[model samples]
Target: MESLQEKNRGYGSIFRNLNFFSIWIGQTISVVGDFLYIIALMWWVLEKTGSTAAMATVAICSSLPAIILGPFAGTYVDRVDKRRLLILMDLGRGVLIAVPGVLYFLNQLQVWHIFVIAAFLSSMSTFFNPALASFLPVIVNKEQLVRANSISQMSSNLSGIIGPALGGALVALFGAGTVMILDALSFFVSVIAIFLVRVKVEQVFPSEERKRFLQELMDGLNFIRKESGILGLVVLFSVLNFFVAPVGVLIPLMVKKILKMGAEGFGVLGSSISVGMVLGSLFLGMIGGVRRKGTFIMIGIVVAGSFLALFGVSESFWTSIFLLGGCGFGFSFANILVPVVFQSKIPHEKQGRVFGTLGTISGGLRPISLALVGVMGGLLHIQMIVFLSGVLVALGGLTGFLIPGIKKL
Candidate 1:
């Protein structure tokens, strides 16, 4: 009871801190704009190209830049001023996305323009993501970390919920071009929000010191290599990505083909997961955070995977929704805890690079998994594949408990 009351107090404190609140509010607005912009962009592409392949190409293009640039992006993040980097990234992406809107109005838009702009924005995300992740630990104190992160996660989830619904309305009224222009305008709001943040940033590298790019990159790799817990984290995610990532491909097919639930079912299933994420993050915030992070993470992963496995075998739509909700809840619990663990362990100086490297390894697995799932799902039963993958994820998650380095951390 005492602990619970303390956690309640912590939640109140998070909102009271004006600096963090300013950033969070601005970020929430921009994120909502991002959601609407993406829906519009995708709608525009499908209309223009009339090609599923084009859609896949755009998705692949978005992932590729982060995979390729993640490590180096982190190095630069560690070296420079994060506030400026963030502002620049948002500005560049804003300008890039806005151009298509103008070109479309002028009736001079080309197919290649969308493709190129998509790639450019994606590349900027590699820098922006890590910088944002690293920045929070600096601005927010350790005690406030859990509530702050929960607030951040909640805002993001809210955007996802609001984005599509709001985007659809805007598109119906003013079309994709207007949505894109509004999206660009959101970036300016983000820039102004960031400008309002008045916190001191202690530089990671000295002004006089300049190391070779490759050497700086290698230092980050070595840091991960030397830390067994970090390596365990990387390897664990790689395994999840390989086996579990394919579930993304399998879920829609399973819904349409096996369950015969169609698009509404798909939307319902998505909403279930989103609800779980929002609720789970809120729950974590209410409880503050767990100290035995690895153990909590291990439990979270195993439970989430088990629920996913159950979701695969479910016949009824409601049952599948229940199981998926459980899975989402468990994963969200663990996800929040993992970042708290990482922020505590990593130095403020190397946070950007470390986070970048982690992001790369985490996201890099999807393409390979998607490829294999695409092929294998065509040949074999997708539900069975999903079932087996869930089991593998559970098994893989257990390995963390077995590894002393990670478990004890």
Candidate 2:
């Protein structure tokens, strides 16, 4: 009992730092804004086009730029000050979102306009993500990585739970444009929070013989290929994302068409998933860390895939909500473990590029999946398409078991 007590205390001490708390706060605020924007964006697109394909296209636009520019963004992240990179990314997104709002007020809003903005915002996000992944270690000790990630995940889930519901109400009362304004304001708040945190940014490669941008980009790709564990994880995530894409694209359709619900139903459904994610993150946080993370991740993926399949099969609104919520929980469980494993294993110098390359490839697969689902859902029944996606997701996890290294994560 005494030894167990000491172990728990030791683990708790790892996350007991001022810097980690500050960065965590900034990330939380940013996540809240992201969640709100997700609901607002989906609603706006759905209202305008009245098509699932259009909404999925919006999602594709938001993610494709990030995928295309991921390698370059990763290289750049390694070269620049991460804090400044984060601040600039937030500001860029804030300004871009404001453009759509201003257009709405001027009665110049168009579906294409939203798609373009989504692309630009996603492009900015491409840079932000790798930097944040690399920056977390600089601010927190390695021992606390899991805990920090768990806290971050929990906050993100909490935001997801609350943001969509609030965004729905705001959009219902005020307008989608007004919700955009709130999202923009949230970015400013995030920027200010990040600005207050002070940390020494470590240089990955000192100034000695600068290489061409293209050369540097290739270097990042090569790095991933050479690193077996990193490459394996990237491949796994890409597969997972491809299958999971349909879930995001179809949720709106499920609420609007299948469930015979409105935007408010969408909000409630989204919130239910968030609630489950929060629970999952909290469970991970309490555990602090685990041995054999790879096994845990595989189990999570299998569970998530099963839930997705179940969600598609069920017609009862309550049953769908529970299934989607379970999917969210399993998804977060796998997600939190993946990053922790990568951060723990990958060297600081190589993190940005590896994460970037991984982000690009994995992110790119999602949009293609979305487009496929959106188009297919139009022709086939939504439930059938969703069920197929769930099968793919399950297959992806089963494939992971075949890969010895990933099975061990």
Candidate 3:
């Protein structure tokens, strides 16, 4: 692993590393499967229950694990073999997600079953995600991280473009149960793809007399505090998430209420953002390494926020599409760079915990932001709330320039 980093290979060499390529392929397949699974599951729930509340309940169940198990999950990831853990997560999710399809076939499927499976799956991801973050540095050289992330980002965006349309069509033709079964099969394929990867990970901590879980968790938190700009970055992202959360909730309203464009218009607006992200990632990949990463992060945020503010004021549907696309393009810069910063700045041994802590903070913020959006939705016009949120987000990005902690990073 150390030898790979020392090589300092060119950007295109990222794909030549079979280890990284294997995992990337696995992750790409898994991401698309996830979209298929979610669309099928949510659609089935809505179709059967005829209640939006049930759909929301399922969503809440899926998110609870990350908020609850985040720190602990990270600690565990640091203590174990990440490769084995990734396989286990894929295996577990593949099986658990299949339960719904099996039950449906047996005429025993229930809303509660979906809830339980979703929670358990989320718990697995809480560990899997951090482990993957920690594992990446081990497989690829440092020089490849940016391009690797860009390619990964591109795959996700591509999946976003393809998955929902394919999932919806499959669900319409074959039923949700069949779509879910196929998703399960996709995970198994991921397991195989992951199994082919090979790498030797060094032991970071001594085996004997390890600290208690809570102590290690605090150590992770303290690391964040002591590190330059990291804590600020975390705070920035948490607040940014709060401001951005409303965009998803309000887009449909803007299309339906303001533009009177309905579901077809909403789909078009959504796809535009995904297309923009794909292009943004491609551009980043072409540029290779960015010298002033902090400046890039702030620029990305401001661009995204500016477009979002424009989106709020867009009375025309086509205008809203353009604005949302710009929002996605701007978002990609910050999204890809933030992880690169973390992966580069943090120690490999502590990366798991740091990533875990990030998951907790971000996941914990989701519900609060949603609730605030709901409250603001009732009091003020949607346009006002979105415009204000965008302005605040843009200003929040500007703070990175003012605060020495973030600016110097």
Candidate 4:
């Protein structure tokens, strides 16, 4: 008995209320641009310096700033309007990216320029992530959190699949500077998409009129310390991150040294992982949401770690590709579970601080892991190093069993 207009209105309301789509679209654009910039920057550094350490430095600098600024950024995100915060973060990054692009065109490009820009962009992203993570639950219904996170993961994976291939061609044809220009433009597009979304912010601790900065920070830390389930998840993820960090540095080495492939091969290797991630994400999205998310996450991590270890040992290109792809799929599956749990359990008001603290711990450890991986890979064989990383991840998974909630999830 319902009219078509009424039916359509129902659909319209459903779509509009789901702010995940908006965030997903914006992130997709930004991620693709980021991929392009990453390829371009790495190539630019290699061309200029011809040093693997120099190239590795790019990764370290990019991550360190976020680790340093994460706590303060998280605290600020909780206090501010998340929508505007995202917009401003995008704009800030866009302008920073433009600095190098403009200078490169004017023939003033240098390795230091890339380092500075990478650090600046990384710092901006520290603010952006905690805000975005905390904001998602506010805009989307709790029932849709898993689906929303899955869709977001799909967008990121798709970007990973497409962006590197596009970046390779662009780097070959137009140069890194041009690719950077494209990245800067993508940020503008993201800013526009974020601007269109409307969100209702909930204040968690209404009784605390105002608190000192250090007091507020300590409060966030205390919240995490008090929440056993959340604390356990954070510890579990941090250990996982420590082991997984090697993959980024070691993948390039494997393609270049072990596989004896060039830049195109590197692109192919990266794209292969992305392909698997996309498929995994699609599977998760179609399923709506997993009921036993923690269990699923643990299983995924175990599978991913196994694949990564196999990937390190494989000699044939196809074997390596398949293993890496499998790893990507498992990684995506595990990734979707974490954010859903965080959004579901953590109070909306405290999300910023909690996620920030988690970010600080996880993000801080990554670069140290990368540095260790780089140094170890340099000192030992790449395969052995990678295999060790995989072993660590698998061992870390056992920690989940110790945390009862994680095993139950």
Q: Could you say which candidate leads in lDDT?
A: 2
RMSD of each: 4.1, 2.5, 3.6, 3.1
Candidates, ranked, TM-score: 2, 4, 3, 1
lDDT by residue (200-287, candidate 2, tens digit) is 7978563476677677777778877776766776888888888888778788878888898877778888888888888888887777
Please give, for residues 229-277, the per-residue lDDT of candidate 3 as tens digits: 8888888888887777766656556666789853345546666776788
The true-versus-predicted C-alpha distance at residue 123 of model 2, in Å, is 0.7
Q: Candidate 2 or 4, higher lDDT?
A: 2
User: Distance from true position, residue 58, model 3, in Å?
Assistant: 3.9
> Scored by CA lDDT, what does every candidate get?
0.77, 0.82, 0.80, 0.79
- Count clashing pairs, candidate 1: 0
Candidate 1, 309: how far from true, in Å?
3.5
- Model 1: residues >4 Å from true position, as ranges? 1-9, 37-56, 99-115, 164-182, 206-208, 249-268, 313-320, 374-385
Candidate 4 displacement at residue 307 in angstroms = 1.1
| Pairs of residues clashing in candidate 1 | none
- Give a tens-digit lDDT track for model 1, residues 1-409: 4674465466676777777888898899898888777767766665576443455455666777888899999988988889888999988988987998898788887767887887899999899988988999888888778778888887776775666557756766777888888889988899899888888688865346877777778767777888888788777887786777767545655666677764445545755665666777878877776777788778778888898898888878888888887887778766687788778888888888888888788778766665666556557776788888889888878888998877877
Worst 10 residues of 1 by lDDT: 50-59
Worst 10 residues of 4 by lDDT: 5-14
